[model samples]
Target: AEIAGEYLKKGSQVYVEGRIRTRKYQDKDGNERYSTEIIGDRMQMLGARAGSGEPREPAAAKGEAKPAPAKKPAGKFDDLEDDIPF
Candidate 1:
């Protein structure tokens, strides 16, 4: 399950819904203390870049790096993905 929050403006004028809980405590010097926090459940991306704009191309598909083909010989180490730093 996901909470979809939409139309969140860039600067302000945003709609928000949440709850505030208080913590009752006593200080070391015998003083009363409390704290409040706001928690949210759902949010949505409504900005121009939120939706699907551009598709992602794999590194091997592009000219970035050559992918190891199935026919290629495997390294002596079993952890192949970890062997490459990039």
Candidate 2:
């Protein structure tokens, strides 16, 4: 609520991860209208910030390295035992 109310402008580009629903309702004039609502579980603001010219990036793509599992090998035979006869 705070982010949308304070940070987002009328044309702010955002990526929303959520379920969307489209419902049909009648207006006061008895005219049919379709409304789409997004229930965003996750939302990200795209493009530059309020004043910054440079575009922003997601946290994972911003050079944050995730430590891989210790047991993972670089190659198929990388884990071969030294005592293997084959």
Candidate 3:
């Protein structure tokens, strides 16, 4: 499960290769307990990352359309002066 979890995300698809194994152990009450799990050997991501509705375009296809830089608000601390107790 750990191997498969690494590739899992919202809206993403994953392929896992593994085998099921069962084991027995003693419980807190001294009763025999059994648990079964898949021991994954490999995992593969099948699609784009989560929250990105569409697949990303190749850098070459993007041409000269670069993303705009984040703009800070005018007068960095002008709005915070009134909120500070000090």
Q: TM-score for every candidate vs. truth?
A: 0.35, 0.48, 0.45
What does each candidate score in C-alpha RMSD? 13.7, 7.9, 13.1
1 against 2, candidate with superior lDDT: 2
**Least accurate 10 contiguous residues by lDDT in model 3:** 55-64
Best by lDDT: 2
- lDDT digits (tens) for residues 1-86 of candidate 1: 13332434356232345677889899999999998877765333332334556443322323456755789666776655675667
Q: In model 1, what are the clashing residue pairs, if there are any?
A: 5-43, 5-44
Local accuracy of candidate 2 as per-residue lDDT tens digits, 39-69: 8887788888878888987555356697678
Highest TM-score scorer: 2
Quick one: RMSD of model 3?
13.1
The candidate 1 region of ten consecutive residues with least summed lDDT is 54-63
Predictions ranked by lDDT, top down?
2, 3, 1
